[model samples]
Each structure stands twice: as structure tokens, then as C-alpha cells.
Target: MIPKHTVDRLSNRLTHLKPILSFEIVFIAVFVTLVFFTGGAAAQAPVGGGGGNTSGWETILDNLYNVLYITLQYAGLTILVLGFIVWLSARNNSQRSETGMKLTMGGAAMVVAYFGLGALVSLLEFIAG
Candidate 1:
């Protein structure tokens, strides 16, 4: 049988985590929706690449991609620097150390994902072709 105190602690942790989880779910849903709509719109639009006439939808997508790529690069760099600082400062506290490690790893993963995104897209295109 589980101890009552342990169960209580677990319940408290779950309550605190609920809002964070909900926010993550909502954020993911919105991102997916935007990407889906943008992709569908782009696909339906006719392609034009002659005599200096470009498709507006494609231009919008290219601008959006550029902005997002730049933003991610900056964000990833900030996370990496902050995570390393936190990790170095929290060496005396186990909980803080653990949190720091998680942040560091998450930041590193984001950076890696940013770098790998083009390769991933290329792989998908190759497979689809």
C-alpha cells in the first residue's frame, strides 16, 4: 500500500502541473492549426515564376519562414546561454541541479532541432518524390 503522505505529495504535484500541461496542449493545437491552414492555402494557390510576377501566398510563406527561423535561432541561443548559467550556479542544490540539467538538455535539443529542420524537410520531400 502507498503511504498517505506520498500520495498527497503526488496529488499536489499533479495539481501544479495541470495548468502547464493545458497551456502546452493549447499552444501545440494553435501552432498545428496555423501550419495546416498555411500549407493548404499554399498548395491550392497557383505557382508563378516568370517575368517578375510572384505568388503572394508563396511570398508570405517565405517571409514567415524567414522570420520564424531567425526568431528560433535567437531564442535557442538565449536558452542555451541561460541554461548553462543556471546549471553552473545550481551545483549545490540537487533539485536546482536537476532543473538546470533539464533546461540545458531542452535548450540543446531545441538548437539541434533548429539545425536539423532543413534536413528533415529535405528527407520528407525526397521520400514523397
Candidate 2:
């Protein structure tokens, strides 16, 4: 077993780290928001090209892509925070650990699926064109 002094020291370290953690969180939030807004603006803008005008389907796809991108991006951030919280809690039981793992895996799966679907759609469009 660990000594009480060691535990106390660890607790003190964690307390000291709180401010750094808060700043990291705030920075992440701001960066994600900026990226989302910039990407959204580009997606919303009409694609100016020699393609002789963008088709309705193309416009729809662009909008859908932007929406999906933003949604997935935010969802990912939320999942990460939740997973971190669960991990920080450090449940003694195996069951809780399994639950946290599942949550993280689910979040990862969502990101992969979002990109996969987008790639598939782009491929199909390319082939059709």
C-alpha cells in the first residue's frame, strides 16, 4: 500500500494542475469553433469554377457536408470530454472501465463512419461524372 504522504502529494499535484486543465479546455473549445466557422463559410460559398455552374445536387452535397462536418466535430469534442471525465473518475470496478471504453469506441466509430460516408459519396459522384 502507498503511504498517506504520497497520496497527499499526488492530490496536491492534481490541484495545481487544475488551472492548466481549464486553459487547455478553453483553448480547445475556441480552436474548434474557429475551425468550424471557417469551414462552414467555405462550404456555404458558391464554388466558382469553369464547371459551367454548380448543380443543385452539388450545392446540396456541399451543405450536407458542412452540416455533417460540424456535427461530427462537436460530437467528437463532447465524447472526448466525457471519456476523459470517466477516466479521471477511475472506477475500481471492471464494469465501469468497460463502459468508458465502449463510450470512447463509439465516439471513434462515429468519426470513422462520418468520413467513410463522405468518401463514398465523393467517389460515387466522381464515377458518375
Candidate 3:
């Protein structure tokens, strides 16, 4: 049997942690995996050749795509984390209603959109080749 004082302390600590524990865990896990695997290497370039006189529009699109991809990569992780926090809040409180579910779904949608856009870009590149 645990001591009463110890149990009280543990309960208090857990109560305080209830709001953000899920987000923290997800963020830490993603961060650790990325750090261990990638180790700060830059993104790989798309497989293609410049092939004389790339238009201004093409250059602009390429730069925009690169920026969007990088931004989505980081932002997706953050949304995943925020979704977790919202999930925890919903779980702990009955008043939260469907907001947490919406957040989680929205986060998932952004991740999917990021990948979908990447695939679309790749398809366009393939056609151009």
C-alpha cells in the first residue's frame, strides 16, 4: 500500500500535468526521431534538370513549393502536438465537446494536404520531363 502523503503528491503532480502531457509526449517523440535520423541534413532536390531557360514562373513555383514543403513539415508536427493537447483537454473535461476531435482531424488533414501537394508537384515534374 502507498503512503497517503505520497499518493497525494503524485495525484497533485498528475493533475497539474493533465493539460499538456499528451502534446509534450508527441512533440518529444517526433523531435527525438527526427534528430536521430536526419541530423540536420537539408531536403533532397527534386530529380530533374534545368534544361536551358527555366521561366520566371517556373522558378517562382519551385521556390514556393520548397518553402511550403519545409513550412508544412514543421507545422504539421506542431499541429499534431496541439491536437494531442486538445485531445487531452477534451478527455479531461466534459465541457470541451467536439473541439478536440475537430482539432485532431484538422491536423490530420494538413498532414495529408502536405503530402498530396508534394505528390502533385512530383507529377507535374514528371510530365515536364
- Which structure among the candidates has the greatest lDDT? 1
lDDT, candidate 3, equals 0.76
Residue pairs with backbone atoms closer than 3 Å in model 1 (clashes): none
Q: What are the per-residue Cα lDDT tens digits for candidate 2 across 1-129?
A: 999999999998888874546877999999999898778654554556646565856777888788988898779767866766675576796777777777777777777877887789899889999
The candidate scoring highest on TM-score is: 1
In the predicted model 2, the residue pairs found to clash are: none
* Candidate 1 C-alpha lDDT tens digits along 16-52: 8745468779999999999987777655645564554
Estimate candidate 1's alpha-carbon lDDT, on a 0 to 1 scale. 0.80
Query: What does candidate 3's lDDT look like per residue over 22-43, in tens digits?
Result: 8879999999998899764434
Candidate 3 regions off by >4 Å? Answer: 1-54, 95-97
lDDT of 1 at 129: 100
